[model samples]
Target chain A: MSLVRLCLIMLALLALAAAVAILLGETPLSLGQYLQALTHPASPPGEVLWTIRAPRVAMAILVGGALGLAGATMQGLLRNPLADPGVLGVSAISGLGAALAIAGGLAAVPGAIELSALAGALVAGGAVVAIALRLREPEALILFGVAISAFGGALTALVFNLAPSPVAIAEILAWLMGSVENRDWTDSLRAIVPMAVGAALCLKAGRGLRMLTLGEEAARMSGLPMPRLRAYAVAGAALLTGAAVAGAGVIGFVGLAAPHMVRALVKDDPRRILWPSALAGALLLVVADLAARLAPTDQELKLGVVTALFGAPVFALLAWRAARSWRS
Target chain B: MTAAWTLNGVSARLNGKRALDAADLVAWPGEVVGVVGPNGAGKTSLLRAGLGLLPLTSGEARLSGQRLDQLTAAQRAGLVGYLPQDRRVAWNLPAEVVAGLGAIDLPEVQALILARDRLASVGAGDLATRGVLDMSGGERARVLLARLLCARAPLLVADEPIAGLDPDAQLLTLDLLRAEAARGAAVVVTLHDLSLAARCCDRVIVLDQGRVAAEGVPGVALASDVLARVFKLDGALVESPAGPVLAARRL
Candidate 1:
């Protein structure tokens, strides 16, 4: 299929999923009631749909798209199919930031938690790039990222250990579990600009990513500015990942699975994988969030928990297929 | 005309060891140059340095009478086409897409046409739409050769282009290189087959232990003494119907 047609199909599916997500939350509404509620803001059902569910759905789309695009860019830059945005420790650091905010009594303030998370993610991303400047090998860069991720995880644990109250610890733990629950328009607005900027940068770097598949030596021989391209891709991915982590908690597996899903449908060209991966990611998260809402448990499952439950099996299958093809 | 590519006293280090020690060579347009050496002889290093892909620890590499370092990336790409020793494609992209990567600035239609034409020139036209990873070793080599040809650069630097090919494919590859030379492009290739080098190259350069051990016409450069000292082979130049051939016995 043509890229345009495939993208259109994904967009349509995303719209359908978005509608389902908005209509089926704690206060379920029929299609007719949902439409009526959207049109009339005075009714309680209408107000609930517009003010609460709509923002959550929008957050899912934005955060999912950001993570998906970031993952595709990271995979292309590292030339590893398994690479994800979290592989560089950005998400873990973001988690640490949110933990700090909740532990410090700042969670009561709107946007404070998100701002802290974004700050932490940016710092982690910057450190990765600084280390990458000295290390030309992709393996070395990944190793450095792993070390940073471990450190961030330790810090998060430290925050948990030093919590002064059970309420603060519970809030931090719930936030770390990853969800778009209770998010409002303010969260979406805060994330959109950085998400858009990050997506644009990743899309622009597609050409360089295509050339990079030829390997570093061949890419240099082809006249590609390796250092500049690498820097741009890493920084752009970090931005998207940071923004997504700030908007939602550290949602796992969307970044890792979305691009691979798209690659199975389209060609493996890194340039071609970006937008499709983003759309697929949005769809995946929206559906996963809806499933979380509909689960039989009294309390809704966390978005991150639902994704990991589904995504890990899918990832294993992908790995198996890759290994099989390689053997043949 | 100025030499198409030149390396003057160029030295490079790889993994803290000298890979090219004060290597000096020149390749001119309309000539085919063969670099022959054993496993650690710095043939790959020479080609890489000549293409300005490797940083020279000292000395200079020049192309078209300009210092290599002075040229921008795009300019360097326009001047030299390089094929590294390893021919692995990490992704499963189509062969045509792989070849079209050489000239990404062109329109899609133009790049596709160029890629197809180059594949046909290398006798792998049917493999254009095939996945690179699915092809046999010989098929992959031909496709990669087409990619190298797609650059249409003034100087072509191919390291061990015919390493895994059968006899006929090997001859076809050599003939293709010679054709590129005849088209006024300087072609530099690394070869392990001394007989093929003797038959195909206009001039031969023999490297031993990261240095130029011998260089001149094939007969002079591949002299038995040089072969014995460098390759450690009991070999002699012999007359054959095709051209000069190397007949070797166990050392």
Candidate 2:
């Protein structure tokens, strides 16, 4: 299929998923109310649609797309099919930040938790920028990310042990489980700038990734700016994951599964696969979030939980297919 | 005419061992140059250092009279097309996509069309749509050859261009290199088969122990004494009905 058509199909699916997400809340909104909410600001439907459902759905798109694009860039740059945004540890570090903020009683503040998450992510991002600029091999970046992720994971478990109250524990665990609840336009606005800038930078780094397919020496010989491209891939991926974590906590699986899903539909050109992967990611997250809202349980399902449940099997199938080449 | 690329008194090390020791090499447009040596002779190192892909421990390499350090990536791409010793295509991208990578500055569609044309030139036109990993060794080599052709650069360097090919494919690859030279691109290749080098190259450089043992027209460079000293061969460059062939056996 042409890239434009593939993108359009994914967007259409996103629209369908969005409609379901908006209409199926605890308040039981109708199709008519949702459509009416699009323009009538004074109506009851407008309040729920504009202030509640809209922002939540918007957050899913932004987060999902960011994670998707980041995954594709990482996989391309490292030339590892199984690579994902979380491989760099941005999510775990940010989770640590959000958890600390919750334990500090900052969740009540309008944006304190997100600020902490972003601050945490930026530290990891700083390390990435330094390593990508100074080092010659990409494997170094991977190793550093693994080390830092372990540190963050261990520290966050400590934070859970030191929580002051059950309420604080519940709030921290809720955020960790990942949700778009109570997110507003401000959160979406905050996430979009980084996501946009990050996407632009990652997309431009395609030439370097394409040349790298020829292997390192040949790539350098092609006159590709290997250092600059490395910085772009890591920095772009960092900002993207940072935005998602800051806005919606740590939603999982979308970034890891989106690119693998799209590769089945498109040729495996790193640059060519990015856009469709992003749209597929957006669709995946939106549908996953809708499933989170509708699951038959006393408490609502976490977006992260729904995504992992849905994504793991699909990802396994794609990865299994990919393993065939290793055998042959 | 001025040489297209020149490595002057270049010495380089790989893995803390001397790979190229004070090597001087040059090639001109419309000529096919071959570098021949034993496994440790540093033919790969010489080409790599000359192209500015590897750093020089001493001496300078220049392209178009400008030092390698002074050349921008765009200038380098325009000047030389390089194929490394290990032909690793990291992904299973389509053959056309691999070929198109030669000219990434162009739009994807334009690059693909340009690559398709080059693939046709190498007589592997049918391989363009197939995934490279699924190809046989010979098919993969031609696909990579098509990638080199896609660059259409003024100077072409390939390491072991015909090392693993059968006799028929070997001649076809050599003929393609000669054709590129005919089109006025200076083509450089490393060959293990001395007979193939004698038959195909306009001039050949014999490397021994990381130094140039001899360099001249094939008949002079591979003549008996140098052959014995460098390759431990007990023979001479003999003219057959087809062309000059290295008639030798292990000493």
Candidate 3:
């Protein structure tokens, strides 16, 4: 299928998933009733829809798209399919930042934890980029990311150990598992601008990313400014991943899986993969969120938990195939 | 008149060892100059320095009488086209698309047409729609050569352009480079097959240990004494019916 047709299908699927998520909440509503609530105002159902479901759905799409675009950019910049947003240590540092906010009793504040997570992500991403500038090798960049992730993980553990209360520890742990639960318009608004900017940056860098598929020397010979392109790609990915993590916690696997899935369907042109991967990301997250809500258990499953459960096996299979090809 | 590309007193160190030591060479338009050397003799470094892809430690490389470092990246690309020794395609893009990458700044339609024409010139017209990942080494080399040709730069620098190709493909590549020179482009290619070099090149520069050992017409540069001294081989330049051939055996 053409890339445009596939993207349209993904968008339609996303709309359908959003409808299901809105209609099948704790107090289920029929299609007619939902339409009435959407069209009419000053009704209890309308109020519930506006105040709850709309923001949550918007957040899911934004976060998912952000992570997906970031993943695609990371993979292209590194010239490795195994790269993802988390590979740069953004998500882990974001988690550490949230843990600190929770342990410090700042969870009661409206945007404090989100702000902290964003800060942490930027710092980690910046550090990785600084190191990458000095060390141009892609493998070395990933190794630095691994080291930063370990540091962030250790920091989060220390926060857990020093938690003031068991309730605070539970909240921090649950947040790390990732969710869009109870997010309001404020959260959605906070994430949208940065995500838009980041996506735009990725789009601008897409042509260079495509050229890079020819390898660094060839791309440079073709007139691409290597240092500038690398910087833009890294910063764009950081913006996207940081914004997504701030809004919805550290959601796992969407960045890795969305781009991979889209590449399977479309040509692997890095420029061509950006938007479809974003749509696939949104589609993946909405479906995962819907599954989380529809599970038979009394409490909903975490979004990260569901995505990892589904995405890890697929990733493992891809890695195995890539390794086999390399060996042969 | 300024040469198409020139390296004057150029020195470079790669991985903490001297790769090019005050190497001086000039390539003019309307000629194909072949560089020949044994392993680790800095042929790649000479090409790279001429393209300004490597920084000179002590001297300058120029294009059209201007220092390479003084030009913008786009300007440099417009002046010199380069093909590295390692040909790697990370994805399964079509051959046409890969060739079009050389002229990425052009409009899609123009670039595609240019790519197709280049592929056809190199006898790779049938492989335009084929995936590069599916191509054999020789086919890939042809496609990549087409890409370098698509750049249409005044100077083309290629490292080991016919390394893995069969004899026919090797001749085809040499012909394509000659054709580029016929069109007023200066073609600089590093070659391992001395016989091909002798048969094809307008001039040959023999390198030994990061410096020029001998340079002139192919017959003079590949003399028996230079071959024995630089390559450690007992050899002679035999006059075959086709041309001068370097017949050599290990010492």
DockQ of every candidate = 0.68, 0.63, 0.69
Off by over 4 Å in 3: A1-3, A30-36, A100-116, A119-148, A162-168
lDDT of 3 at A39: 89
What's the true lDDT of residue A118 in model 1?
A: 80
Give each model's whole-structure lDDT: 0.86, 0.83, 0.85
Per-residue accuracy of model 2 over B1-251 as CA lDDT, tens digit each: 87888989999998789888899888999999999988889999899899987789998998867788898887888889999887767677899999888886788899999999989988889899998877988988898888888887889999998988888889999999999999899999999999889889999999998899999998888889999999998998778898877778899
lDDT of 2 by residue, A79-167 (tens): 75756656567788988998998899888887787678877876776675566445454456666767877888889888889989989
Per-model interface RMSD values are 1.1, 1.3, 1.1
Q: Is candidate 1 or candidate 2 better by DockQ?
A: 1
Candidate 2's iRMSD: 1.3
lDDT of 3 by residue, B134-230 (tens): 8887888898999999898999988999998898998899988998899999989999888999889999999999999999988888888889988
A1-328 per-residue lDDT for model 3 (tens digits): 7878988988898899888777777777777778879788457788778788778888999999999999998788767676776766778998898889889999889778878887787787677757754664555776787788889889998988989889998999888899999989988898898888888888888888888877777888887776677777877888888889878888877988889888967667787899999998988898898788779887789998998898878768766766564443
| Per-residue lDDT of candidate 1, residues B26-101 (tens digit) | 9999999999999989998888877776779998999878899899888888888998887767677788998998
Q: 2 or 3: which has the higher lDDT?
A: 3
Tens digit of per-residue lDDT, candidate 1, span A187-282: 899899888888888888888888877777778888767667777787788888878887888888798899988895677888899999999899
